[model samples]
Structures are given as C-alpha cells and as structure tokens.
Target: MIQVLRPARFTELTGEDEDIPRPPLSQTRTAQQSRRRKQKKQLERRWRHSAVVAALTPAQAAAVATTHADATSALDLLTFLSRERSHEYSPDTFATLALRLVEARRCPADVGRARVHMIRACRTPLEMTRAMDDLDTLARRGPRMDLMAYGALLVQLNTLGMIDVTRARQLRQASTVHPPILVFLATGLVGSQVRWGSGAPLPQGIDLFFLSHPILSTLASSDRLLPRSPAHARHLFDGMPRRKKRQSAPPVSIADRIGTLPDSLLHHVLSFLPVQAVVRTCVLARRWRHLWRSTTSLRIVGLDDNYYVDVEELRKFVDHFLILRERTDLDLVEIKFNEFCEEDQPYVKTWVRFALMCKVRRLTFHVRGSQYLYLDPHLVSRHLRTLDLDGVGLPETFLDFGSCPVLEDLKISHCIINACRILSHSLKHLSIYCCHNEFNCRIHVSTPCLVSLKLDHFIGRTPLLENMALLESADVYLSDYCKDVCLNYDSGVLCGSNNNACQNCVPIEDDCSRECVLLGGISNAKYLKLLPGSKTFVFTRDLKHCPTFIKLKTLLLNEYWCEAPDLDPLACILKNSPVLEKLTLQLFSEGPNHKVEIKGRYSSMERPSAISEHLNIVEVKCSVVDERILKVLKFLSALNICFIF
Candidate 1:
C-alpha cells in the first residue's frame, strides 16, 4: 500500500486550516548542561560511596567489584538506570526487560516504541502502510542508537535529510485533530525537516550532533508534495551531505511488528546466538538477509552454546563470516568447542585470529576436549583487555605478550605452557591453575606491574619469579605433581652424598646461589599463601635465601613448614616479616607413630621479632591427633597469642 507520491493538502486531509506554523522545534536540555549535571551526579555518587571505598584495601576493592557486579541490584547496569528514587515499574516495563542480554550490549526494549507511535499516528491502513515504509527509509541510515534514544528517532539531527515526508504529512494532517516520513519524513522527532536526498542507509555511528542542530531546519522543503532525492551535490550545507540517494527500501510487510525493530537492537539479540544460528535468520525475511553480516559481536561455537558443530559446516561458516561480513568493531568474541578432533586446531587458530583482527575487547577461547588450541605469536590485539583460556597450549614465543598491548587480566586453566619465560608489561593480574609443562624448565616471570598472581596446583619445575614490585596478593601451590622432591642422600654434601649423590632427586630451587628468585619476587605481597605438595621441597629450598617480606601482614603455610626435623622455614619467614599479624598452618600429620616434638627443635630455631611482638593469631588444621599434632600444640602454646583449630 505504497501511497502515491502526490501533493495532499493538509487542510483537505484532516479537515483543518492549513495555516498552522511548523511546530516549534522540540526543546530539550543542551549537551553542555547535560554534561555538567552528569558530572555533578558523578561527584554525588563518589561522595555517597567514598566512605565504603576508603574503608577497603585495593585487593578487597577489586574482589568486591568482581564478586558483586553481577548481584541482583546490578540488573539495572545494562541500561540507563532510573535516576528517580520513587520510579514506578509499570506492567509494560516488564516487556522490555524480557530481552536477552549479551555481556557487552543489550537488545533495547524501546526499539519499537517509536514505531508504535508511528502506528498510532496513522488514521487508516493506507497511512499505516505508508508509515511502515517511512520507517524502512529512516532505517536506511544505520540503525544508530542515538537516533533511537529511548525508542524515539532524533529527526532534527539527521544530516542526510532523508526524512519520511509521507509520514510527516500524515502527522501534520493528524495534528489538526490529534497528531503523526517517505513524504512521511520524521519531522515530529527532532522538530526539523528531513531534507530529501540519498537513501543508501545512513552510515553507522554518525553523531556530529553539533553540526546537525535543530537550527538547521530552515532548509526544509516548502510543501507536502513529496520530492525525490537530489541528483548530486551542488554546494553542501549543514542539512545535506554529498551522499547519493539510496535505493528505495525493500517492501516491508504491513503486518510486521517485530521486523520494524531497529537493526542495532536486532543485532544485539542475534549476538547471544552463535554465528551458525545468526546465519539461519536470513531466511526469515528479506530485511534479515544481510543482517548477519553486520553484527558486531561474534560467537564461533557449534550451532548453539551446547554446540553440535560440524567441521565442514564450521569451515564454510568461518569463510563466509569473514568474507561476506562488513568490517566492524567486535565488543566480545568467543569460540568454544565442546568436542572436536585434533585436526581442527588450525581452524580454531584461524578463528582466534579472526576475532583478534576485529579488535575484540573481551575474548574467551575454550577447547574443551583432550586437544589444546596452541596460541601463536600472531595473537595480537590492541583492544584486547581480558582473555580467558581453557585447555590451551602456549608456545615459548607467545609468552612474551608482544601481541596484546592492553591485556590486563589473563586466566588460564587446564592448559600447558611450553615456555621458559613469561613477560608482560601491561598485565595487571595473572592466574594459572592446573597447568603444567612438557619438560623441567623453571618458568621465569617478569611482570613489574602485576597486581595479583595465582599459580595454583601447577606442575613441572617451580616457577622462578622476579620484578614483581607491584604484587599485592599471591597464592602459590606446589602440588604432588610438581617436580620438587628432595631425598636426603647425606648431610655432609647438603643435598648430595659422594660422586653418585642424587639426593636432590627432583627439581629443587638452586640453593648454591644467594639471589632469591621465587620467594624474593613475591615478598612485597601483603597477603601470601604458600601451599606445598606432600613431599615437594621447593619452598624449603627457596627458604635458604628468602627475602624479607617487609609488607606481609597475613601468611598461610602448610605442614611441611613444621615437619619433625625443623621449623626453620617458618622461623625464617616470621623473622623476615616485621608487620605479620596472622599465621595459619594446615597440617596432614602422620599418627603418633611419627616422632614429632618441639622441645628440642623449637629451641634451635631463633625467635622471629614478628612472633614476639606483632604476631596476634595462629590457626592450625590437622589430619589427625598424634605425637606430631601434640608438637604443633606445644608450639602454639609458646606463641602466647590465641590459636584457632
């Protein structure tokens, strides 16, 4: 029901006088005023939260934000939060909240509000059909959210001048009694005339708001006789740019309620789906045919999150996605393989490169099967800030971190690092869990800006760390798989016997050197936990030259620190830490059969200043009550400070 492009008198259309002046430009707060108010509100927010923030240490603050951002009250974080203390949540509000949310962006619920307004403005089916077409034309410009702010179009700010003149005429006619772009231009939106010009959808992200001010409405066409787009640019004005007229939009079904949604919103909804499913949407309607190609977020999984991905289909999709799609910024990209053969590693690597090439800010790569996706030197992205890798392999070259300059947090689990050195200048936090190496090389890490480090249950040689001046908290665990076994061959040779001495049967830290590597690097941490494996002696070896932990306030050690022979390691650390206040020991002691006593051993170990002066609390957890357990109780009794079991 495309309305004929003809002159329709406003007076005749709605039985009213045609002398009505163009509605005064809709007024709103200015950007500068809005900014000032926004700043003022921000200051107020800071003031309100300042006390709680001041009470938190940096580590606690980071933890709280990480753990609380997804709490129930954070639901409003996805959209503009209600500023009013007594805001009403009407029944209709629930409809908008029903939209699926991708982590980075949300499918706006208000997308159809303006369309509904247009429908309401229409007096008949003819007008309704014409209005729908006008919406198509309005969308020819990208589905820019600024235009769709709060579900309303910002017509006054349109530089393309491609208004729905047809709808404008209807609104003008309706306004005679009540109210209402293509000849129905979006005049009512910004209170400015939509100049007749090119149709190629407006470019995405166009908001030279200053240049497209409502004051530029003086350039509107004189009457309702719908004008075709201009031939070419003569002299350019603020109202019109030199864009060629876009072809008339594909016909939209007059009955389409959901199709009328802005593409930006639709794409957001589609982002929650894997690309395989996004491709299926093209068959739904003509408008959706090319929509999949423009989506900014990508999830390269099987058809769904519970993926049933086929290799050949994924291959075809990968090629189609990269080749057919227009270049755009990726907010978040994830590639998770539930199950795939080892041969697909190359394809997975290629997919990772594609995500990186799009400048993704957040990426998650998981190869969930027995296979691991080997990271390459080309894993670069200036925009990459957070990366989560599971079941992946890191090559020696990949550890340099020259690729991702802005990478801040990296969490790797169930992975293998075949690297000797791990260095990153921009990384703030690094966590590696259940990861191991192929050989006996001790990984060396030099991250001067690191704030938090966690190496839990990692295997292979104990890592040698340095240059961690900014470290605040560390949790290092030496699992049974760790190559730090010490079999005392003979006391005379320290860790060896005669020529055949192999007392140091495993990968123990070199005690021959005075430069403390592992313990010294993390000495600045305020909170430290060192959990050693049942027989691993890496902590003991490092204890020989452990650096003074000047900032330590809390420490947690394991049973090995007080093994029957000596409590020297515990004494050494306690002596080094001046401000230490709390100590916790978790023991899995053997029963009474093991000869354990502090009577002789405690006297041999010199008392650390922290124990006599600063130490306030001690906690001990035991596997069983035995002679060894009694010895630990004896030691706690001597501390005088209260002890918790």
Candidate 2:
C-alpha cells in the first residue's frame, strides 16, 4: 500500500500531490522556443519555393537559372546559353538579368556568360524588341548612364549577329552618348554593313575636339562607329565645311600655314616624335623656332656607337636650350653624354645652375669623364624632387643637401663621392651604385624621412647609414672580394682571422663587430649566380647594420651568393619580413660557357632543401637552358609552384 498507491488519477492528482509537481512551463522560455521553430520552418519553405520556381524556366531560362553566380559558373552558363533559342525565356527577365550580371565584377565568367546569353537570348523577334526598349530607356537617362557601360552593352548586342536594321540604328545612335562611345561604335563599324545614311555626318570639329580629349583620343583610331573605308572616312571628315575665316585675320603669309597650327596641338603631335625629330622640326618656321624650348620633358639617348657626339656641339645645344628656357620652369630635363672634356665642364655647370634657378622638378645628368669634376654642392642640391646621375663625379667637398627640403629621390650610379656626409632631412629615396673602386667612401645619411635605400658595389670597409627612422625598403648587393662586414672599430674589435691588424687590441667603446658574408667556398657557390662569365665585377661588403625594412614586399636579388656567412644574415631578413610576397632572381653571364657553369651551380642551390621556408612565390629566369634551370623547376615543384617560363 505504501509503494503502490497508484500514481494519482486526474481526479486524485488535484493541486499538490506528494510527488513534486512538474515545474510550470516558464512563459518566456516557451515563447522563445516556439519563435525559433517557426523561423526555421519559414526559411526552409522559402528555399523550397525558390527551387520550384527555378525549375519552371524554359530551356534558356533553365540555363540561366542554373548558371553559377560566380564568374566561372556564369561563363560556363553563358557559353551554353549562346547556342540556345531565345524563345525559351521571357524577354523582360532576360534583359533584367543581363543588366544585373553586367554590373557585377567578381563574376567575370558570369558576366561573359550573361553577355553571350544576352546575345543569343535576343534571337527571338520579341526579345529583340525588348532589347531595343531597354536601349531606349538607357538613352533617355543621358549622362546618368555610364558611357562605357552602355557602349559595352551595345557592343554585346552587335556581336550577337542577329540584330535587325532598327536595332542596328539604335546601336549606332548610342555612340553619341560619350566620346568613348565613338571608339566602340567605330570598332563595330569595321567589317560591318550597318548604315545610317541621309543623316549629316558628325561635325568636322569632332576630330579636333577628340584630339584635346584624352579618352576620345585614346579611342579615335579604333572607333568602330566610324566608317571603315579610310578614303571614305577622310572624305566624310573633309566634306564638313570649315569655320569661316575672319576677314581681319592676323597678317600671315600662306607659306606659314604649316606653322599656323595651335601651339598646344603642335606640342601634342611633337611629343609623340623622337627627340631628334623634335629638334629637326624646330627649323620648320618662325612659329616653330622656339617650339622645342616649350617641351616640358627632354631625353637625350645615345645610339649604338653613334651615342658619342661632339662634346662642343652637345654643350652648345644645352647652352642654347637653357637660355631659351630662362623664363620658363622646366618640368624635366635629361642629358646623356658619352664623354665630357674639361672644356665642357663650364657649360655643364651652367646647365645645372639654370635648372636649379628654374626649380626643375626632375633632372638627370649622365656624363662619362676621365677625371673627377667638382659639381657645385648648391646646384647639386636644389629644389630637385627627383635627381638621377650616372657616371658623374662628385666634388671632394662632401655634398651637403642643406635640407634639400623637397628632394624625394636621389639615384647615383657609377659615381665617386669621396667621403661625403649626405644630409637630406626630406630625402625619401637614396640609391647608390659604386663600381670598380673601394674609394673608402663613408656616407653618413641623417634622413629621418628616408623610406627606401639601395646600395650596390660598395667597397668601403665601414659604410654608415644612421637615423633613418622612416626607412622601409632596402636592396644591397655586396662584392665577393669584400667580405660583407659591419664594424664598431671606433671601439676596436678587429674582425676576420684573415685580418691580423688588431689581434690583441683593447675593445673600443662602440666596438661594433663587422658581420662578414663569405662566398669563396664551393658550398656557397649554390647561392651564387646561375651563369658564370668574366664580366666586370666589384667586391665590397660594408653594409651590415642597415635598419630593418618592415614594409618591404617585393625583393629582387640581382646577384647573390649563398655562402655560410650569408645564411644567418638572410635568415634574419626572412624572419623580419612578415609580409614579403614576391621574389625575383635575375642572373646574367658574360659568355655562353660561363653562363653554363653559373647555371649548374644555381641548379644545385635551387634544390627543394635550399628554398627558404618563408617563400610563397619564386621566379627564376636563366638565359641558358642548363642543369641549373632543371633544379629550380624541381625546387618549385616541391612547393607546388606557379612557374612561368
């Protein structure tokens, strides 16, 4: 009786039985659970409904509906839909979807597919009618519609090859939407039979208008809307009546018509010609006499053996050019001379002075002289934002860019700067290439704003680059003869067992140790050039204490050796670079045989075991096909490489 008093019946279970009453359902919890279940059911229902609706499409509609929303999927779908009949879908839906697809970019495949679909989707007469309506809507909006977008649509329509005359006429008229429209139209017109006759041709001034418009000029030659026949097109252009001449025109002879062109247009045309041609054209007429002086940029490039020109003539030409530009601020001036004589020094100095006076924005001087020439420090350090000097000698007096203030870039190659303390507070870029001399040159750059520094062929035992807080990227190439080393010899800790100069010297205060990169051993040869040759070489290794470049992303190692000393240094670099993405190695050899030897060494070094762990992408280009090339391929393959040959 104690255990089996039957669980109380409903009548006996009233109110409170001995057993704890089941807890009353909490209203809040019950309501929340109900809501969640309801929401889930609604989602499932909606998804099912969408699937059913998609399955009801015609053959074309089915293809489009099944088209992957992504680029690849869209492309595949479009290709399939192109061959299908247009009667399979509602024209309105097709046009709407096509427009939407075209507007998206992530789905390039999809856009391409939609384009093909739109082209083939218009096979039906009804579809074509709908497309024309769509075009009309687009046209009515005028400038609201992007000219490029509209033109692209029209091009797609034309490419379908099924457009009727009326549609073609609409397409042709669309060209007037913008100047770029003309290019697409012109492209379509080529090998095309569409005609909008009896209508007056576009105004003759259109060509002149396009000449001044960057976008229009870019598309003028390939205008598909323009007539294809060059002669007919010329006639059409010429047929348009010219503006009436003023009765009171400036007093000018008919012989001067050649020079009567507007200075701006003349300059534009001349800009496309070679510098030599530009000089020759200056002799055309009085109006053209000062034309070359008006050039904003000048580049003097030497040809093969003809690169050598008479120094006197070159100096005279520069002198004349500078005098003519006395009043105007030259934007860019470049001078390349194969050789400079003592007599030419005065003229070169004058040119530099004038450039500084005019506040030249960009200046480049490449002069090859036997003896070092002293360049005025003041002229060398001017308002120049960009300066590139190659093979020019620097004065003994260290160049002090007393706050080049605005100098952003400085590049010097094959130049001798004897113990210069370069001080440019605003210098953002510094590149120096020293070849064939360990001139004991010490560069002390105190540029807090420097962002990039590149040093090549440095032979100094101690190269100092201090206090560049903003430095971000650096490219350094050391020579083999000069061990890559850094020293605090001021405190005196002589490094390298090979150097017995200070064997038992007391440690100096700033006794910084020199880090050397040795590349003489055969094991280190793998890291050396893939090709070998008796090419001119420079050896120096004084660049070791340069600041870390945290923002460096692309690194190009022109000629690198993988010696034991270089391993730890390179590892340190890789450890510091957290965002490096691309690495390119360029190798060159003096001769074919030398290239083979270098390539063989490169092959051995490029083995899978030799690749750095941090490398994500590697590109190796070897001029000669040898074992080195094969090794690189294998190395890259082990990493599942994306290689280009």
Candidate 3:
C-alpha cells in the first residue's frame, strides 16, 4: 500500500539543479596549505611537555618516556613510573601522582590530537587489546616489561573487567616478591572476588594469605591514612622495598621469608594488636607462632571470664600467655580483672613478679573484689616509672618504695592506705582518691620532687608534707562525709587516726578544724584549686592563722556554696595571696533537699587588706547573679580588676 512519485525531468521539477562553477585549483591549493601549516604547528607544540619533564630526573624521565611509548593513559604512565622509577622518585611522589590520576579519572595532560586518540582508543577492552598488542610488539623490539610494568597492566585490566584467572596469575608471578605490588593487585581483585585456589594456582613462594584483608585494613587504618582523607598511601608504601631476586638459590621457605624480619620490628608490629590477636599470628607459620613471646607491651583486659562457660580456661590462657613471654624489658604491662577469687591471688602475684622481673616501665593493676587484696610492695620493679592501682590495700611499707627508684607518677583510687608515711625522692606526680586511712595511720608525703598533687575524698587526718618546695599545682576536694561530720557539732570533736585527738587538736566554733594542717602543706603552689566539704569547717578564725602564699598565682574555688559566712574565708585567702593573678569562683548548686537561695547581701563587709596589684582577672561562674555576687564584684572592681561573668 506504498506509493512512490518521481519527477520526469530535473528542469521540469519545482526544485531544479543548475550547474555551479568550481573554485580555481590555485585558490584550493593555497587553502589546503594554510590548514596543513596550522596542524603542523600544533603537532610540534605538543611533542614536548616542558613543565612535566622538568620535574623528572634522568631515571624518572627515562621511565616516563618508556611508559609514554608503552601505554596511552596518564594513569598507566604514573603506575609504570612508580615501579620503574622508585629509586629516582620518592614514594611520596609516586603516591601523589597515583592518587591524582585516580581522583581526576586519568584525563591526559597532552593538548593535541593524540590525547583525543588515546581517550577513544583505551577506554574499552577491544581497543585496549589492540593498544596492548602494539605495546607488546614494541616491547619485543626493545626491553621486556618489568615487574612493576606487569603490575600496572594487571591493575588496569582488572579495573576494566577484562582480566581472567590465567592472565592475573601470570601478572602476580612477575610481582611475587614485592609485597606492595602484591597488595595493590589484591585490592584491585577485591571487588572481583578472585581466588588463587581455584582455576589457576598462584606462583610458587607466594604467601598463602595473599587475599586477606587484615594487613590491608591495618595499613589502611593507620593515622597516616584514611582519617587523613584516604590518599596518603606513601606511608604504607614506605615500608615496602624491592625484593631481592635469587633465581639460583633454593625456593624461599617460610622460615627464610617472615623469619628474616628483625626481632624489634616483629615486636613493634605485634604491639599494635591485643594479646588474643597477636596469638592468632602463630597459626600463619611455625616461625611466626613463637614471635608473640618477644612482644614487650602486653595488655590483658576483657570480660572473657564472665562470658566463658569455664573461667578456669581463661585463667589458664592468661597464665600461659605470661609464661610464654620472654624475660626482656617491657614498656608496659596493664592487667585488669573484673573479679577474681582469693585463690587466684598467688597466681596473679606470680605474674606480677614476672612482669616486674622484666623491668616494666608502666604498670596498671585493677582487681574488683569484696575483700581488700594486699599487694606485696617488694614485687614493684625498681625501673617502674608509672604505677596505677584500684580497689587494693597498700601495705605498711607501701610508701617505703626503695625498689621503685625512678617512679614518677602514682595513682591510688578506692584503696586502704596502711602506710603512715610516703617517702620517695623521685616521685613527681601523686593522686589519691576515695581512700581511707587505717587506724593509727595518718598519711604523710616526704617527696621533695613532687610537682603535682590531687587528693579527692580522702578520709584521714590532714596529710603532712615536707620538702615540697617544687610543688607547682595542687587540687584538693573533701567528701560529703566531711559535710556530715561538720553538721554534727554535738559529736564533740573530730577523731584522728589515733583516737588521741583530745590533746593534739583544738576545737573551733563548736567543731574541730584541721584547716591548718591542709593549708600549711600547699603554701608553695602556683596554681591551687580547693573544694571544701563544708563552709563552717574551713571558714574559721584559724583561716587568718595560715602562712602567706608567696608563690600562688591562680586560685580556683570550685563548687563553692556561697553563703553569708563564706566571705571571711574568701577574704582570708585573698589577703594571704598577695600576688594572685586570676581568681575563679564557681558557685554550687543544691538539689531539692538543700534548696537555699544565696541572695542576701552582707550588711557589713571588710575587703582583704592585701594589695592585689597582680590580680587582673576575676571570673564568676554561676546561674544567677544575686545581691551577694554584686557586692563581691563591686569590691573587686574598686581595685580595677576585670570581671568576667
């Protein structure tokens, strides 16, 4: 049912063809010559990349020229150069170029017809095969592709989904000894799920765990990588050097490969993993199985005891773990047990002795139990620099640390202090929290090198200090128990560790005050933070009896329950600290039970007589500014001090 219509003659048709004259040959030849000249000029201009070539050294330049002739991609150019020019170009330069190519999708830097030809000819598999054949033909005329060249080719083919088992295996063989190259191939094969156990067997001497992601993840998760934006592969590549080629020697055995690493290096590598993860490396080979024994840093902490059906098995693991370690010096040994019976004490103490014999530098012990476990003071290492203990009992000779000669930091929390005197010449930092003193045991510090001290919720007679001239900072916090004791004025007097306070202590304002003992010890502190349990206990007539703070520069009264009776004590400290530079007053908040608003202004006031010439900053932290706060601000402003609320 189709119909066609044709015109009888061209002259008769509505649109007729008329003869048009052709241009002269002379003019056409001139136009063709002009176009040819422009094309030749552009081609000549692109024959050299001055800027890119200027930055390359002789070896790198040679590698660049080789890759330029072998491949048609900016990505492939850098990939081959990274391997061939590794000795000339730093790993960072290779990493940077590789990262740049990947990020920019490998668009060529060449500005000519060849850049467009490369883009069209190498993006697909069929076209790339022809290009590779051309490269192979050229390679045969010159030098064979190196291992790095093979790795680059494999990476490109695998990324384009054109790689097969046989080809990949062949490529892996060329780069078998180079772990960095192997890792690169492995990452490319990740999405493809290629396995060497299947079709084509991996070449001999290759690691059986070539496909594993653990080492890859470890290298990738380092601080120099991922969180820093995932392009910093230089650090990961820095550790990988070119493998030695020994064609005549026997095949590399497991013992000859991983065993060749230095003991220090193996130990350092193992330190990044926990004991359990470290133990798993033993299964890799016989040589690696025992390498965990040389690891100097050990951290044994977890709830495995509670999770396991048999706790004895966990204990056996811990014991075996300690027994297998070498007796070399240790950098750190931290053991925390959630709960242990009394029977486990001897076993634990034996392990402690083992660690001490190894000269542990940092030791942390945490044991949770009902009965207070006593730690033998003699087991402490003489080289111990830092010690932390929780939920334990200190022996009578705990402070007599003749063994720990270099101990610099000590932290004791929720423990019983049986020692009355803490004497050490090397101790610099001390912290005690929620500790109770035994009867007849009043804590005393005799460390001349102590620089920082923090005492929180300590129940004992005020601590005594001697030769603390170097103390730079001190923070003291009294517990709620002190508040209860102060409120119970009818109790007569505060009892000391010796029940003999009847003669040694004096009664002040219906309660016994040991403010002198506490204040007298920290007179040399440049920065002091004090949190009294109750206002009446410290804000007494004895406040004026304390010595002058010639070294005090900054004073912080935290959680101060400001009241009408607190001004005298505040003035007392200000009067004593003549050179105080900064004062911070943080008001206390009371819950529903003690909701007494501090709003009333003092009827009469007497400011500190000391000249606060150096007191330039006064900061008041509170929710609401009451009349009492305004009065204090007015008094401080009279001395030209800056107020910050």
Candidate 4:
C-alpha cells in the first residue's frame, strides 16, 4: 500500500549508519562519477518523507500519501515490492488499505487487530465492522448499539466516512488507553456483531465518531460534544475504568449444544481445525460435506505473515489438497510453510510424500528457511508416532531409526544437524530444540528406549547421551557455544572444576568425557532441568564422572550449578542425589545481586544423605531477595527443607 519511496542510491535515503564513505571508494572514475552525481542530486533535492512517513505509521502515512480520498495514484510504493511486478492486492487494494488503516486513529502496524480493542483482551463475535459508529442506524436504536464494538474499528463506522469526521485530528488520544467500554456492553445487533461488555463513553457528536476509530483511543477533548441528554451516558458510565469490572449483567445464551453432534461427532470436531479451518467447514452444513475428507488431523497453516497476502491461494490449496483428501489413515499432518524455496523443492517432496503416504500418525513439518528434508532411506514408518521438526535438515539416511517401527515421538526445533547417530530404538519422547550440529562430530544420542529427554539450545559437539537407562524426564540446556564447553580457557583443557585451575573442557578420558555422556545419559532421570549457563562447562566438567543419581527426584539448578567460587558443583549434585526431592534454585537469574558466599555454611558437618534422607523441597527463584537468601538457608540444610521462595 505504499505509493512512493524512491532511492536507487544515496544510501537508500535515510538512516542506518553506513559510515558515509562511498563514491565507490573514489579514485576518480571521473571523480567517482562526478561524486555520485553530486550526491544523487543532493539526496533528490533534499528529501521529504512527509514528516518521516507520518512519524512511522498511519500505514506509513498511507504509504507516502497520494492525498488519499481512499488512495492509489501510486507513483511507486517502493516499486510495489521490487524487481518483478508482484503488487497484486486487490479487493480495492484491500478495502483501500483497510480504509486507510481503518480511517485514522491509527492501527495497521503489527496487528492481531490490536486485540480487538483491549479490555483485558476482549473476544467473541465482536467485529462490528471495526467501529466508527452509526452501527446500522444504532442497531435499529435498541439499546443504542449497545456500546458499539463487535470489533473491527468498532464495527463498520459507517463504511469509513465516519459520518463526516469534523475537526478531529487534534491532540488525539493523548497518551492512549480507552474502552470506558461504551455504555456497558449490551446486545441488539448480532450480524455486524456487538456482544462486547460495556462501560460507556459514546455520548454523541457520535463522540466525534468515536474519537475517529482505532477503538476509541481514550476519548479526550470533550466540551460536551453533542448528545445533549441521557445524562451524557450516565456521565460516561460513572467514568468507567474497570467500573466494577466491565459491569456486565447479560451474557447467558448458551443453547447451541455443539449442534446436537453427529456426522461422527462433527468429524471429531473438524479434526482439530486448520487446513483453512477444515476447508471452512464446508460452509457449515450438508453434514459438513464429507467432514473435511474424514478429518484425522491435517492442520496446515501456511504461515507467511506480513499482512494481507495470498500465497497463490495456498499453492492452489496445497495442490488441491494433495489431489483431494480421503486417502485415509492420518491422525496428524501439520505443515507450516513460509515461502519454502528451491522452487518449492519438488512441491515439498510431494507434500512429504503425501504425509508419509497417509499412514501419518503425527508429523509436523515447519519450514521457511534452512530447509532440507531428505528422508526415505529407511523411512517406511509403520504408522509412525509423532515426529515434529522445524527449520529443517536431516540426512544420514534419516538417522538409522531402522525403518521407523512405530516410531515413538521425536521433536526437533530450529534443526540443521545432518546426523551422526540419533539411533532410536522405538524412541520414547525425545525433544531437541534450537538444533545445530552440521558436523563438528560428537552428536551421538542413542535413545535406548528413552522416556522424555529434552536437550534444549544445543550447538555443536555435545550431544553424546548414549544410555538413557529408561530415563524419566530430563531437560538439558548446554550452551556457552558448547563444543564441550571450557572453550579454550587458557588453551589448557583439563576441566576437573575451577581448580585443576580448570583449563578448557573435553579431552579428560577417565575423569569421564569421552564425549561426556550428557549427564551420564540422564543418569536414570526422575526429573532434572540443569538449565542455565554463561559459558557452561558441561555440567561442571561432568563432575569428574559423577553419576550416582540413583533415580534422582526433581532437581532444577542454575546460576550454572553453583558457578565455581567453590560450591563444588552444588556439592556434587547434593552428594549424588540419594532420593532428592524437589530442589529448584534458579539463583540470581538476571544478574547483579551478590553474596553467593555460603562458604559451605560452616563446612557441612552433616546434612547430605539428600540433606538427611530425602531432601524435602527448596525452591528459591531469586534476583535479589538477599542475604543471599540467608546464605541459601545455611547452604542447603535449607531449614529442614521446605524453604520455598
């Protein structure tokens, strides 16, 4: 919707620190083409971004305003999306740029349509044509359009003319915050919509056409502007600002009974909606016409968002929903494509081989960038069980999960790793977020009947979690770049804690780390989190070969495991967790709060057999609830351990 912004040079006109020194490094190509044609005609005759594009938005000042009476005399809205003629937004340029960013009280930018005029995020049918008033003649004057707001600029505001806006543009909503919720939300109109809970404020000149849109942005400047009586809406409903919590007294209308369910329970509730709302629920009838081809979940959200687009009718409705659905057996097929290039990789490998030839069983493929999906070496998934991926990349013949025999849950986010062993033996819940191992070796993860392991934020070489002894919940996060962390510390390399005077990490062999088995493959986990790091040393150099978790019970640690001033990796995981029970400890999370000096609180004479038999509960969030929280309550004898914070 931009109509002009020309800058072929002159450093693309306006600001972004480009160090001001280019006339192609000047050595006289005719004095650098006459000093770049006299600084491109003095920045095109001293530029004029019409008050910096209306001070950044009003739909970029109606895209360089061609004096809009509903725009479009386009003298080049920045080449209307450069280089190739793709300016195709018509429905009268999207209702004329949504009627000039919905007629003025500015909106358009980053919209979830401004949460339909926020009153603690209002919801429901409420879209009265993005409001400007005269709501279909005040919904035929019954309950005076009940505080007009079935949302969209308070519903239709008289097709954007705003019933002839008078002198409004002054000191507009100075310091926003509105919704003295239009006279206590009432009903009367449902088609253009209006079940919004009310509070008041529209006492006519139509309240200057609801202070010119963007959901009544705090209607100020009043001199009793118009509506002479009705006690100026009970004086803006006793000046509402949560006038007794939106003061509603009429919302009982529940008889829809899920439409007396049938059509296989409404095709199992339109198979948890999405493929464009289950093909717009076949216009909601004729038994939802084959109920979105026997909906067993196909959730396709082509997420390309910028605003007002088409994606070639979602690539011709996903090539006509892969030649019109009904090829049975799906249970889940989520797809999120955002421009997926390489000429759409053979139509996204024929839509992931038609969701693994319909024996789908949970598959979410999120793409946009870093795309790569070369599977099928042994992927004959016998009705696979959950495989979520994002960003993308995966090759070593899809990591020898030996033909997915009922593959058991795998999630990978922000991926890229081209395999070096993700050996799953009928995997059981594995999640790896922010993935990266393109190859710097050490990426082994033999999921030997794993049960819930989530390695978050990984980078290169620190995967190695070989055993999993039937783990039960692990959420590891090891990033201080993580190539076995201790990253070149004094270029030495023997990380046996801060005083082998701890050199960088990795090559320590018998003191463990032959690829430091990521916490000895979750040490038969019973819930662990091990999250934080500001240059982690893989669980403090795997505390020399510390493995007696003995089915640990809920530990969460951070301040990177008592980071070094000798707490001894939180006293070697509280003397190797002998039935530890809930011990949170996030520790000064967002820095600057000192006193970590618990100094083994007078040298631990007694107390660790999980703080004397089964550590009870210890919580601690912290940022500064200081005395270092009473020296971590005498350094973890935590006052008979129920010291939550």
TM-score, every prediction: 0.53, 0.42, 0.52, 0.27
Q: Assess candidate 3 and give its lDDT.
A: 0.57
lDDT value, candidate 1, whole model: 0.57
For candidate 3, the C-alpha RMSD (Å) to the true structure equals 24.2
lDDT of 1 by residue, 368-395 (tens): 7656667775466789999998888888
Q: After superposition, how far is residue 474 of candidate 1 from its true place, in Å?
A: 0.9
* Each prediction's whole-model lDDT (CA): 0.57, 0.48, 0.57, 0.55
Q: Which portions of model 3 show Cα errors greater than 4 Å?
A: 1-266, 285-287, 303-313, 377-380, 482-484, 488-515, 535-542, 559-566, 589-609, 638-645
lDDT of each residue in 1-645, candidate 3, tens digit only: 222222222112111123322233556666745654564344333323334423445454434433331122333333333444442332223333333333333322321122222323255676556545543332323223334455555455555666553354343233222344445654444323233333544433222334332344453334443222123333556667889996775765545665688888888787666577778888876679777866888766553524322224346677657644545589888776656677777767766776786788998887665667788865456799999999888888877876788999999998888877888888999998888887443466788888999988877654556557889999988765533234333222233323443333334432224445467778899999887665234433246467788999988884443443335566677778888877877665433233333321112126544545677566665566677667666665554554433
Candidate 4: segments with Cα more than 4 A from true spot: 1-160, 163-261, 269-290, 293-297, 301-313, 316-333, 338-365, 368-389, 392-412, 415-430, 433-452, 460-472, 475-481, 486-537, 540-645
Q: For candidate 4, write residues 1-645 as lDDT tens digits.
A: 543444322123332134434445527557865754564444334333434422333344334333433122121232222212233222222333334443442322311222222211222223222222232222222111112233343333334334344224211211121223331322112112221123354433344544444323222323232223444444644555663556655855775566667666776676666677778767754556666865777766643333322234466577556544555577788777655445556666667777887788888877754446544445667888889888777877676777887789899888787877888788999998878887756777887898998888788767778887898988887766766665434322234434554344535554335444677888888998887455666665566788888888888777666545546678787878877766777776643454332222112335533342655555666655565455555556543443323
Q: In candidate 3, how many clashes are counted?
A: 1
Poorest lDDT segment (10 consecutive residues) of candidate 3 = 7-16
RMSD of each: 22.1, 28.9, 24.2, 27.8
- Ranking the candidates on lDDT from highest down gives 1, 3, 4, 2
Clashing pairs in 3: 282-289
Model 2, which residues run further than 4 Å from truth?
1-282, 289-306, 316-326, 380-382, 396-398, 435-441, 467-469, 481-561, 565-571, 576-615, 618-645
- Candidate whose lDDT is highest: 1
